[model samples]
Target: MQAIAERSPLLSKYETFERGLPSHPESIKHLRRQGKDSFEANGLPTTRQEEWRKTNVAAIGRTSFERVSQDTNSLSHEQIRSFLLPDCIDLVFINGRFSHKHSQLEDLPKDIFAGSLANALVQKPELVEAHLGQYADLGHPFVALNSAFIEDGAFIHVPSGVTVEKTIHVLFLATARDGTPTVSYPRNLFVAEESSQVTVVESYGGFRDDRYFTCPVTEIVGLANSVIDHYRLGQESLGAFHVATQKVYLSRDANFFTHSINHGGALVRNDIQALLDAEGIHCTLNGLYLARGSQHVDHQMRVDHAKPNCHSYELFKGILEDRARAVFNGRIYVHQDAQKTDAKQSNRNLLLSKGALVYSNPQLEIFADDVRCTHGSTTGHLDDEAIFYLRSRGIGEEAARSLLTYSFAGEVLDEIRLEAVRKEFEEFLFTRLPKGDIVRQAV
Candidate 1:
């Protein structure tokens, strides 16, 4: 069955696109061919696979989604403006193609680089070639697919000792002006040099209610003493399928922080991997997922402590309503040479209905005896005592359940350093909180 799915028409269409995908300097072409080969060999993960046991993407394989086109004139600027971050350099992509008209690149520092990856390959091929396809795990089919079809996405470069006062926002808007189910591969590459500081926001959204597939891959490199605040927001339409892979590489004394908020899509999965390649690295990964009405959301993370004196922390929270399903898999690995490594991971889920389900697995693999590493996972109904206490304080039952649920997910939101983004998530979370009927019986 898995083999049949791999050979499905959807993959064939992807292969066609892969063959014709643009390539320049010949090396990128070679990388594209490599991506195609790897994807074909590995194929989509099956439920039988350990990493994909709880989440099945057979439906995605069965759906015949067309390749996303470059035409985005149907979407108005006003429609995409709401998704942009305030006081930030916004790089907008429509249907996997960069939009100069909708993007704001003015007044940027002279040396800093922020623009489309395709353009970067043409103008600054040397810098992009050094790290284009280096960090993405070719083992992952989605990553391979994105690599194979890599075209236009955000490309940002900050030199040493430079601090970007404003955040860099990369927004991808998926639209089906022709009313067809489409698929887009959005690839982003970020490089922060030594002692540089910056904040980046990656947002994937839809301009219409059309069914689409958004497969995006982001690779980040943080040099020594660099500080990076990264945020990913997945808010696709209800009929969309979204899968993304984010890989972060850190050097000595580098600090990298990530926060992911997933609130939309019919089937969504996020793979976040942070590599502490040098000593004295500080890494934090936090996520919040809200799903309902048969939606499926999954977040998988891996933090690798490759050197001594590194610290990593991970926390992921989820709220599921109706018949929604969620999966959280987090692993912290301390290498043999990673002495004095301190790592902690926790995953908590709140189910608002009996039909809602969650599968959580948090694991710690420590090879160094001197390291402090621990992981914890919990999945259950909302706290009854807290709900009862709120009810006893004269709050209505629905309001009480909502409050507790919000509090449960708020912990992860507090980690977002950007106040505007935090407030936006708060509004979206409140609006998505199961109203009346769904909230009445959570406790």
Candidate 2:
């Protein structure tokens, strides 16, 4: 414990942060206290732990990051225009606090509440109190840290029987501060009531060449017969560290789909878990990550089938170049009562250089005898035969390689139902490839 305290400065800084916090409701205060206690006990995880054996976060533990108390409104609309998607309801947050000046909420449907979590705590305390800090587990140190500083983020609620035609986009922007490295905890809660349908996109981005820390936690609840499509896009600074956790709970007959796209960050870790609590639930999780330089990206995923007659699918792919490294651990758990549960998980990796490394593990823990569950993982370089075949078709070597890489990544991108989001990713891919114009023209 003393060693952990010596390594992590946040333990001491947390006391000051709690003392200076503004007055909140009793329930919220209790939640913060719980978070503080959990973090104090666990501190930060280390390589000795099984779950974190491969990913080391010693740099994050050693840094003394400044926690901003208020939002920074220094950005103009033009500064963030490039990050915004077309034909969507946009909600922007700067340094973890919502920016009303830049958000567009006029098109929100009736009976649907979409805005800042901090404002919702004041305007609709009951609704905020009911679901806040309910699903996300505090055992993880980062989740506890985010819970300890739960102040502002996106809050979206779709009432019963309402279908949201437009996509709700929540953008979190992190800017660099002068003195010390900064940190922000953005806590989001998304609740879809019974028989409702909605699509949400959560995007994280930072200024170029910035060094900062972003620890965010998002909790999603899908009521009976609800249909939800969620997209989490991470485009942090190449020198930044990002650790995020997303917890999802789906009731009977609920349909849920999520896609995680990671393209930036020096050190990134994503933990996503979904719980199917009742029968007849369908859940899908898909992810794509691209890493280069010395960047490290880790993804940990879990799907719990607690009830019978549920189906879940998971597919994650990674492209690594230079000395970049990545890790993917996916687990599907089936309870004894979860009979007739069908689950499939796959993780694939493409290594662009000899120094690039990947550790992919797909697991299944099934207690039910009458169930079908399959998992597989593959890690290798781009197929030389395929590249040669493409080169023989009058394509340049660089363009052929880029085109094959695009084709490998397109498998996951093609699953995106939103045309605007898909196009945005496609453009991003073109910009990152060598001889991008040729690849774009060939594709």
RMSD of candidates 1 onward, in order? 3.3, 1.6
Q: Model-by-model lDDT, in order?
A: 0.86, 0.91
Candidate 1, which segments miss by more than 4 Å at Cα? 1-23, 207-209, 434-443
How many Å off is the CA of 138 in candidate 2? Answer: 1.1
Q: Clashes per prediction? A: 0, 0
Model 1 TM-score, 2 decimals = 0.94
Candidate 1 structure quality by residue, lDDT tens digits, 36-70: 78877777889999989988998888887887665
What value does the lDDT take at residue 347 in candidate 1? 92
lDDT of 2 at 427: 95
Q: Where in model 2 is the C-alpha error above 4 Å?
A: 1-7
Per-residue accuracy of model 2 over 86-108 as CA lDDT, tens digit each: 99999999888899898999899
